[model samples]
Target chain A: MSLETGTGAASDPAAAPEEAAEADSLGDLSEFDVSSLAYGAVGTTVFLALWQAAALAVGRTYLLPSPIEVATAFVVELTAPTTFTVPFVGASLPATRLTANLLQSLLHYLPGLVVGSVLGIALGVGMGWSGRLDDALTPVTRFLRPIPPLAWIVFAIVWIGIGHGGAAFIVGIGAFWINFYNAYAGVEGVSTHLREVAASLGVDDDLTMIRKVVLPAATPSIATGIRTSIGQCWMIVVAAELFGAPGVGFQIINAAQNLATDVSVAYMAVISLVFLVSDGAFRRVERRVLAWRD
Target chain B: MAGLSEPSASEPRSDDAKVVVDGVGKVYESERQRVRALSGVDFTVDDGEFVCLVGPSGCGKTTLFRTIAGLEAATDGEIRLDGDPVTGPGTDRGMVFQEYGLFPWRTVRENVAFGLEEQGVPEPERSSRVGEMLGLVGLAEFADAYPKELSGGMKQRVGIARALAVDPEILLADEPFGSVDAQTRDMLHEELLRIWSETEKTVLFVTHDVEEAVKLSDRVVVMAADPGRVSEIVDVDLDRPRERTEPAFADYVDRIRTLIGE
Candidate 1:
């Protein structure tokens, strides 16, 4: 026992001396650790400095507005109501508030995201677990998964009649495939040995086994799928609304045609801001759910 | 089919055998060829007996273990527990895996309670049984700890506790100590013995290690590869706390090694 403790206490004698020597040379002050927040601050500062230099070099607000101009445009866009002309009806629509546009985008985005993710995960898990189902679904998914989300816009316009529903259809398609592949890979990647372990412990039935073992084991992958879709769906929302909808994307396009480039940049910034908030919120929840990983 | 903790009246009284392996064989068939993993394997583990299946790399010990556990069906013959045909994994048979297949998401206590929960044991009683199992494995202090935080030996102990939670008539262990360090393996062997005596459950341990078989087993079944079949059965009447350095222990090891064509 004494010998064991002796070895443990002097486990790294060679390293210990070097550490002492280094400590003497360095004095009592500890090494400065660059935290994530500090790194973010430095990165933001560098980015703004470069942007300001570029704006000064261009000296053209219409081409590339200065940071100050864009900031001022952001404030104007945040408070101002937006209007769209109905070309076919020959009538001007009522001016919609910025908050209303944001809500309009979410109206479709959330439903599209929830429904698509739920269906994708369900299909992925079902096909992965059952050999018969996998065979039947493989070819269908293979053919469909390759088609891009934007490619569905024509169908969305025809089927959904060009509204928030149409935009949601496009967004849903994008989220679906991402979540499908992730969930599929997750379920497929589960260790066969772990299944046997579950069986040995009396988790014999298929449904119970899936619930008790397979789902929990595949959670990390499923969580990754959900988080990825959160960001991917946001990208689709901005692009999906380019047709005709009350969202930040439509606002950007409307501003750009009028030579209000700063307003366009402001809308783009709002998209980025919205994405950051959602992604950050998701990460916090993801960390809690996958606490077992830590 | 019954509560594993209580032995029924019809439980194999005359046979005194907890497990009976009768001419069991498992064959895997693919497109090109048919591979016979266990060909005409026969063995029996009596109630409260400590038996070890020792063999070389390609041996069907693991295959046979799985067959008994009912995780894999024998292509020929059958395995019986308490004189009833073994269909699939039930509360009556529990297993310990080599890789320590404890659910990383669950605490040690929850893991121990897993089988019991499956058995539909409820509330306060389940908690008490979990407590007892943790105490039995000497992991009571670490009940709330996750599998990731425990050492290899501790994880194996939790595995054992989980298996024993449902009070299975037989415990099948596939190289349970294979991953632990040498000193920890020795400590686990002793802990297993103590638990075995205390619980009085029949143990069917499979390993490639000859010394481990000699040190722990009441009877060691030696197996060979190439169609994978049992070649010999050696009875180890060695006393408790058997030393690896002893000549008798060395002889037993030599015998098993020779039997497996080592």
Candidate 2:
């Protein structure tokens, strides 16, 4: 198992000598061998230094803001209050700019991700497991799948109006296709041998066999789809907000338009930070769910 | 080596026969071709008897096994279990696979309890039976471990335990020890013999290995390829804990090897 190999590599006495030899050969690089965390710190420092040098060369804050300028703008966005009007109730609430934008983004993102994933997985499994359903849906899905989620922006605006609902519709469309294909492929690719085994074991009906055998076998693949959608829906979140929705994407576009480029960069960093945190959280859950794999 | 014995003649159905495979044949047909996998295959596995179907690749041993298990339909003839025709897979027959087909997601204990759960055996009985099966296979310690955590031998033991947990009349093992190492295979052979004696369940084991069939089976049904059919039925007239080094054991192996033209 990976646990054994992982621990073996970490504790191997032979590895230490080779690592020491490599460190000695590198001179100044030996100091960086403290840990992966130290290496990450060093890498970030080098990246910031390069960015600072490039920003100095450009000498235009509007064109390319220095890391310090973006940091200042990030602090300002975090500390400053923005008025958020509670929809359907005219009460106004004060939240930091970062918090307000994040909440606004989540207003569409969470619902879109949940609703789209549920429907997509249900339909995908249905189509995959039933030959009749597959035959019926294949042509329609083939036609619809080629059209991009962004292409539906016109419909979203016309039908749902320019708000959270429209943004959610777009994000939902993106999530739907990713999950659909994955669930479909997962169910389709379930081992015939396993089905036969289930049959011999007195799991007579398809539904019982699917619940006991097919679903568990296909879980790894389905999990892959869900994990992919978690990160992918974030991209969709930004794109959905770009068209007159009040979120981090809107802030980025608005700041860029006003030539407050440092504010735009800060908002972009917020999106990255949010995505990293969300992805990491989902990964932990996925690991626990799929612990059997290891 | 002992002289070749007379092939057993096809007799009328006896009351002792637990499984009756009468002229069972399977044909795989498509637009391009129709392949006769098994033709006029006949055999009888008596109650509490250990029978091994031995053949090479394309010999249709597995096809016959599947047809008997009711996992696949026979194009011709019928397989009767306790005088009833097998229309589909039922709880009466428990099958173990060469691949050690334990669900990876389930613990070893859970895998053994699957058939019992399907049979709707309640909580106390299911848990006890699962524990009993695990103990039978000497896997009591690894009960909570997943299939992936075990070796090939251990996995097949779990498969065997799982198959036996339901307390089926017959255990259908499809080359279960075929993938394990030789040393482990020997140990498993002894374990299987002990389990067979303890449970008194009729066994229909399939294997390509002539020695494995000779080692485990009370009767080895030799099969031939190019439209597979039973070539001979060799009764292993030997004592329990039969030694591989024995001349009679080697003779049985050699005779069966010759019958399969291998």
Candidate 3:
């Protein structure tokens, strides 16, 4: 297995140009062996065409706005400015609707994601490593895991009020459970053979064994959990903002209420674009850190 | 069984013996069933002696090896090293596994340096010792390479280097060459013999292959299944680099094979 991966890694540089040449061959449109990017492009074009035809058939922009109308709304949202006041200093500033909304959403997302992920990983690794802790907490976690993040909105509203803090609490709940389960499973799946090897190598105590052997062994699994949460928290972000949080999700709901369906679609696309950027960045970091796996 | 030597279970421990397995036994008990894997297994490995435990699949040779290594506890008796009881695993006995248990995330140098690092051997000394071990294993050129970039033979070489890095008194190898091909296995046998002679460390090797047992050890401890026990211990009085094609070598292999009912 190691030899096979070594040869594959060695040949990757030579394989890249051939794959690029295959992808660049636009003349063979009927061929089924194009690159995945080309296939994605073809699929997206077909989807847009189908969507345009459906919009024309409906003949109602208020219900299902056409792609062109949504594009126009996206441009307007990107360019139009809204007044924003800086807290404590009481300075008013003008910022674009897209920029202000994105900033507001990030204010709720970043802190919640960071704090929740840390706490989740700590508790997960603790429970997974110690059988006593796992036995003590398993029943409570099993009961709480089934409840949705949105169900905690009532507590969020009562405790933190209807703002970024409240929205962040909901997003944090989602992030916590996703990361908690992944880290727990990852640690549990660590190989017994590796632990024995560590033991024979002079690692006598549980703490030293866990620090040197278990953590590195379980890193790939923990990384997968974090990556999943990176995208999953975005979903929670939109659901979190549905009440009264001043973010892109809030704009989506507010525009839909005013019969501006195109604006709602525009905000939805913004969420997707942010998710794609964050997910892609995280994947690059994952690949670099887990380069040994290949 | 006719040509085989007497069972060494009755032999008392000598003063020069580095490891003594005194009536050691292991039983695995669960809710469903209780399995006696080893029963009153006894052996002694002298200082700097190379010994091999060979048996059938269910003979508990591995269980015995792991018990001696202190990775598992004996059910009835105890294992002593240098006149001291082995309560658990320690740096004094380094282990080489069949699966080449090198840390996949670490480079060859890091893997070799692991034991020394745990021993708190500081920087320059640790680096130099790791370099020496890698050179001894003929893997100095691949020191910076990860385990995934190496072949099976090379990985096992790293495993050996890692085991030897801590300067352990005993080297416990559990089928270290079992995963490699025949040619690689032969080469590793020569390498292991050279290392044993150079380091003067007592080696307790376990394998199911009769030929491997004959080729590597100063004595072969033949084991039987159905509650594993020592069938016989055969002393090989051959010289260094013994010829496998010789009649005496084949005689020992055949005698051990028959003793195991193969």
Candidate 4:
């Protein structure tokens, strides 16, 4: 009783070594888990080793490029300038590196992602809430869902010409289906009790009930749909550009046509890098919007 | 139960009652089977009276309560409130659910202000009412907290605050204390009684607990399970601040249990 642990008292000596040991165990990679980072590094090292072994055995860059050759080609693509066509404006513009390529690809990707997502969610909510709309749209959706997004390439080229509009149309179709099912399931999954609660609280009207109760309750699902489409659109964008558009995918095809596999692989890696950065940015935004889920 | 003097005066007269549930019945029929939730269930609550509809799980007390709340339509008879037939959910009736139906996405203050917003009350008055209701439920300090951040008892308190925020003529609470622990249930019972006496709004509380019924109700209407009929109505004439440990309190609980054939 004589000794007291007063406010802002001196720290315990026994805990100092424990804290020091903890700090020593976790020196760097503080932002991420150290063991998981180690495992990822190990995985990449193993993959590169296997790839190098195969390349050395073949002893040919044209057929199978080494990791070093591909890395050097990647740096060249990052810095080199090239000639390209501006899709809608019909102007041939000189641009440097992957920057212009990514920007042009985004010009198509952004519009397609937005338009497809908006239309899909709107239609999905309508189908879920009203039986008549569901019956009318269900048959058409089932027929369209079977056709691959790539099949739209011929129609896209025919309708909008082989340009950014054509590529964007293909990306839009891919994004449409991803968001459609999610938004439909989201609205349908709204709990009956929640609707009853809304009714008892003076929100008996159909419009207010959907807006205040159904939408907020289904937001987690809707947000997930948007996130999934963000990545799916990226996949469609590269393929859409591969057919006949000016972007990283076109760069890959042009290099491969000249039997330069290293350059093709370099551009493929660039697309992956872009996807990683964009997906990471999206995750941060999604977390903030869906904070209620926590 | 111990007989009290002049129980008839406390009985709800059709002309003077706040809620008159006359021969109300609810039947749910599907292709597979026909289920009757309530049959010939009749009751009335006088103006400002605190009544509890006590029954077992399948007794259809909830169906009857929902009918009065205007969430469900009765297949037979009508529920008249203030001489008007209950058509649908309106501003005149506020309901508290067992699961504390406060929207998880909304803050405590916003949840309480939901009905007010629906009624189109202006910002100044709405804020004042929300502040008052939160204070009444002792949740003024936690006004900005979400429902997920609260305990079971506090969530129900938010539900009560939200229901009373609109100042309805009748408060319908369907097992408001059902999710809370026993200790918190006792505390909520006291809080509900205080709020009821202060607001003077007629309350139709539904619960399966016999002790809760005897403690809170001016009258407890025991319901039967099969066919969901009204078995017997027990007149609880206990004085204010009735103690659960008292012999008379035990007698009232036992009388209701026997009436329901428990």
What is the alpha-carbon lDDT of model 4 when measured against the actual structure?
A: 0.84
lDDT per residue (tens digit) for residues B1-262 in model 4: 1123334534546555788889988999999999999999888787878889998889899889889988889999999999899999877888888988778789899999998998899999999999999989999999988888999999999999998998999899999899889999999989988898788888889999999999998888889987898888787888968999999999998898888767
State residue B132's C-alpha deviation in candidate 3, in Å: 1.1
Off by over 4 Å in 1: A1-40, A80-97, B1-16
The per-residue C-alpha lDDT of model 3 at residue B244 equals 90
Tens digit per residue, CA lDDT, model 4, A1-294: 102231112245555665645554454335356568789999999999999999999998889999999999988877789766666678877876777777778888989999989888888888877779999989999999888888899999889987778988988898888888888999999888778877877786779988998888888888888889888888888888888777778878888899999988988898888888888998898777766565
List, residue by residue over B1-262, the lDDT tens digit for candidate 2. Answer: 1111323334554745799998898999999999999999888887777889998788999999889889899999999999999999877898899998788899999989888998899999899989899899999999999888999999999999988888888999899998999999999999999888788788899999988888888788999999999988888877777899999999998999888888
Ten-residue segment with the worst summed lDDT in candidate 4 chain A?
A: A1-10
How much lDDT does each candidate structure score?
0.84, 0.87, 0.88, 0.84
For TM-score, the strongest prediction is 2
Best lDDT goes to which candidate? 3
* Fraction of true interface contacts that also occur in model 1: 0.65
What tens digits encode model 2's per-residue C-alpha lDDT throughout A1-294? 333444555567677766645544554344445466688999999999999999999999999999999999999999898887766786888999888898889888888888888888888888989999999999999999989887899999999997889998988888899999999999999989888878877888889988898888888878888888888988888888889888988999999999999999999999899989988898899888888896
Chain A TM per prediction = 0.82, 0.86, 0.86, 0.85
DockQ, candidate no. 3: 0.79
Model 3 over residues A1-294: C-alpha lDDT tens digits? 333444554567766765544444532443444466698999999999999999999999989999999999999999998876654577878999898899889988988898888888888899989999999999999999999988999999999997989988988888898889988998899999988998889898989988898888888988888989888998888998988888999999999999999999999999999999999999999898988885
Go through the candidates in order and give each one's DockQ.
0.59, 0.73, 0.79, 0.65
Per-model interface RMSD values are 1.4, 1.2, 0.9, 1.4
Native contacts recovered by model 2: 0.83
Fnat of candidates, each listed: 0.65, 0.83, 0.83, 0.59
Error of 2 at A11 (Å): 14
